[model samples]
Target: MSVEKPEGPGVIAEKLGAWIADVHASALPDRTVEIARLLLLDVTGLCIAGRGESYVRATLQATDPGGACTALGHAGSFSAFDAALINGTAAHGEDYDDTFEGGPVHSGAVVVPAVLAACEREGLGGEALLRGIAVGAELMCRLSLVAPRAIHSAGFHPTAVIGALAAAGGVAAALRLEARQTTSALGIAGSMAAGIIEYLAEGTSTKRMHAGWAAQSGIRAALMARGGFDGPRTVLEGKHGFFKAFAPSRAPDFSPVLETLGESWIMETIAFKPYACGTMTQPYIDCAIALAERGVQAEQIRDIVCEVGEGTVHRLWEELAVKHRPPTAYAAKFSTPFCMAVGFFDRKAGFGQFTEARIHDPAVLALAGKIRYVIDPDNEYPDNFTGHLRATLNDGTVQEVRQPHMRGGAREPLTGAELAQKFVDNAQHGGWNAALADEARGWCETVFGEPALGTIARFRQ
Candidate 1:
């Protein structure tokens, strides 16, 4: 999943700052641009989809109103930072944002909000927005590859901490910051980064806020640097650098993050989640759904043991009783036992499946109670997500099912048509009418082609 040891020493922050300063919209490959557009669409849709969610409402309520930027579902404009905060939180509120498996981080959730908010505030065009999104989202993916699971291993959330750096890079790129300025922005971002996995213990909403906080933090850092605020240019590789503080267990390998720079795109492989739950839990949900498809009724199964990667146990499998009976819908999204059980019964784990009513369903809890996990030494996670289920039937018949990898991932990505449908569905769920949803879809198709980016006012309530 990660480059095990450090590559022969290199100045990371300075090199990355140079690349961010030089990357251009016109120089980007066609396929890469297409990926960026899809990501833009996906993140916008997720933001709209997550509106009205309790966590989103809390964010909106806590944030002061009145600024120059637009939030998808809200009627009025907001400050650029507040808009970024709300949009980013809403995008990830339902855990429906895009993910990359190479190291497992959500790119769109963090980057799109910060860059788009800045563009709206500055009246920047689609090209600038696109470039910013590319820099930010791609950085999130590449950064994940630096130390991989080490971040999670150290009890920190990768998306939350690394996302600040990615957001800073994206905002700096969008604003055309100089190399030194960009380096200082990244340096400032390193200290601003903060997120812990303590939210996992309960079904709390703190994790949802991580993306937004990071996004805004990035913007603040970038703007501060642009204003001549100096910070450590060696923030990334110094003794007290970001990696040492967050992913303390491993020596970071800079290859995945620095080797290609703008040459090859790691963000192209970004995975859209088919399910609305956790990234690692997606494959297992597939396995359970497949088991149901094979005519193995829930009643016929006595107990099922899932073979899972050692890395996943703490987050998804541990607290066995809690996994079986997740405290809230939010908690269920991370509980493999509950997710698989729900997926098996419902055949899907989308927005509809994550409701308070559905999460408390008697059948789902019963099936979840029957499911358990056994750590498989050979199982791959963070690198490649796979699933395996061995069910022991009441009649002594054992049925085994395995999912080779996560669907909607680089190995088997979701089609544009599917993503479009998902976008429309998410818009509808967020309270937009069909016509409004269709308008949003049309916007996604052509927004990047526009000479100037426009507001999503049509999608606003």
Candidate 2:
């Protein structure tokens, strides 16, 4: 007979944990494994490149250096957790990390680090890393969908808050916890959950630190649960639960978590970013660039009007109103006008566009001045991160462009080769040696054959 599944926040967490474990133990298809491998390369590259940032530098200076794992651009050693935190933040430092629409957050940076750290500490292999990623991503997406947009509207950075619980759950699943123990871990994570949207008001290093804090906090929660520490079972749906406290507008449906289980994986829907800006602004950037490519010059253009969904405006353009006219690298990265302007003037927006010199470019600023945004009530912002760009050029010529999605998202994913190249490019930024990079890649490629994950751990060390 088919059994009835449990309900409520705590039970949902428990059931989701079991579901993640089951998916990992079963054979994952070749496509999923390959995707995981590509992302591993990409994230590792980012970790290396971002090591010089203030947060990562602080971590390097504060921690006892060990050769556990390679920090992106520097030669240093740190505890596994500290390394993961630094690496995770570094990967996402440029806002070029992967994202998902259903639950608007960067899943890989927060989840991948937790898995990698656990794999190194527990002597696990690639297959185990893949499983941990699956567990963490699945739980994160499911929970993010639970409250839908409520948690975010409440000023919580899902990547850091819900992502923490998911990261912890992924680590716990990798370690093979029972239902009650896993639920206890969720309870533990629930208490640790914290992140805010204050970073947008003034672009600061805290945003980059959120992913690391989440990954580290989750690891701590899992370890505590492993030692039999008990926590609140109804953390998500309790009287003063996460949803109730954080998102009171509309309650999230928990059925999505159990309904699919292993069948409909959220990992498949992940979106890797091409431009290093807010995910909401990507579509707008893409559209703006298209207009510029079609012989549209900034000086010749009369006015550039953009229509975007409310969610996009709220999350990006409106939320960062003061930064619309950016004076710093972080501001430019988060600003709609700045991203759109750079894409139009430069034909492309990448790491280079957000540089100290580019932020003050006269051409970019002039283009940004002509650009104005209006809410597209009909357009899909959060759900459909597509936008409509209308450019009125000299001689009264109007050019319009629209993009439903950018490359690297599940709908338009990057090829394995492209992901590999991106990793190499980012890795080089951190000054990683080619020989070491090749070794790391080779280790990941041959991980499954090894009898124990001990060898893999040595590679990082």
Candidate 3:
């Protein structure tokens, strides 16, 4: 069958492609490069930590392909595509990767794996890899802003939908493809973009795999374009384009995609997670931790009520009964009530807090059952993820706390020491010995200053 053409000419994809092709590491601002390095370090730790998850193990067993690229935690190497798929999955498996403040998409989980895999396969240097990552992240964040909440409203996961194109952009940069080739890659990626939000209903592992799948699709699209395959240049803004097909109810604003491409770096706004749960639930965890620090115990509380934004209700707060007693460990991460309860009882939320045993803890469940949310119409969401909490004591005393903004966002970024500790903690959690953990930490500390990613590719060793 012959494909129909988008009417007239399209400049959105062309502009993006030209920018990605021309940008290099030396041209990037110092802060942007530093953030990219930190993200790389953070995502590498997350991948290692996620390797032992049930879903990741199952995926590794099912697709045991061998090639030239390292798969992060695995002792063996795999094809660039398979490596990207597995590493991306590992990065996002625990929902601990960095999130773009604007799109809320897990940018590192998708872009990092694709860029790293391509760099490894092509023998590219660290500078090329870092530049590719920065470009890819900017594209993903901007694309998400084009339609705002349209993707989620249409029952699609923004990461999976927007990630494919972003991955293509990154991989194309890694390969140093020309503008025409990069544009073709992005156009091909549009056809590959797909991911439904159905995992929310059952709390399955499908959501964990979305980033990896998008990464694999992007590498394939970029490779196809390099091999002379042709695709539409208007895949993002033309008829039957990404937003038009995925979000029919909304009109996409194309300005974000091309406005201030070089002068402004959206990747700088990417936020690392303090908690292992959903992005929106991070601020609430802060509130719960604050309350716990104030000496509020589960036994001393009569009821816990949280005020949430209207936008978060459908995904995190609805189905009150189910949210209180989540069916699985993965499900509990998306359950605001469950996360709140865990935060209060443990005074922290991390990899250990999301285990199956902890999910069914009597004390946590008791507090979770008593938890409920009232929609705050004045709240900000899809812009700033904020949280508010209220606790009514058994003595008729009520205490309230509000997290004005997300902790790890641009307003309050993690310090260098904090980031280092996080990497060490993740390494320990992933079953690495003390020496290995320290070694990994040291490598990440100096990787940005190195000439090539030869050491990073061998991190599993």
Number of the top-ranking candidate, with lDDT as the measure? 1
User: Which regions of candidate 3 are displaced past 4 Å?
Assistant: 1-10, 448-451
Q: What are the candidates' C-alpha RMSDs? A: 3.9, 3.7, 1.8
Clashing pairs in 1: 67-78, 67-79
TM-score of 3: 0.96
Q: TM per model?
A: 0.97, 0.92, 0.96
Candidates sorted by lDDT, best first: 1, 3, 2
What lDDT tens digits, residue by residue, belong to model 3 across residues 98-125? 9977677999899999998888888888
Residue-level lDDT of model 1, residues 1-461, one tens digit each, is 84343344376888898899999999998878888998889988898888888888888887887877888888888888999999999998889889999778999989999998888888888889989998898888988998978999999999999999999999999999999899899999999999999998998999999999999999999999999997787688778999999999999888888877778988989999999999999999999999999999999999999999999899998899998998988999999999999999989999988878977899989999999988888877779999989999999999999999999998999988889889988988888888887877788777776777665555557
User: TM-score rank, highest first?
Assistant: 1, 3, 2
Model 3 lDDT-worst window of ten: 2-11
What lDDT, from 0 to 1, does candidate 2 have?
0.74
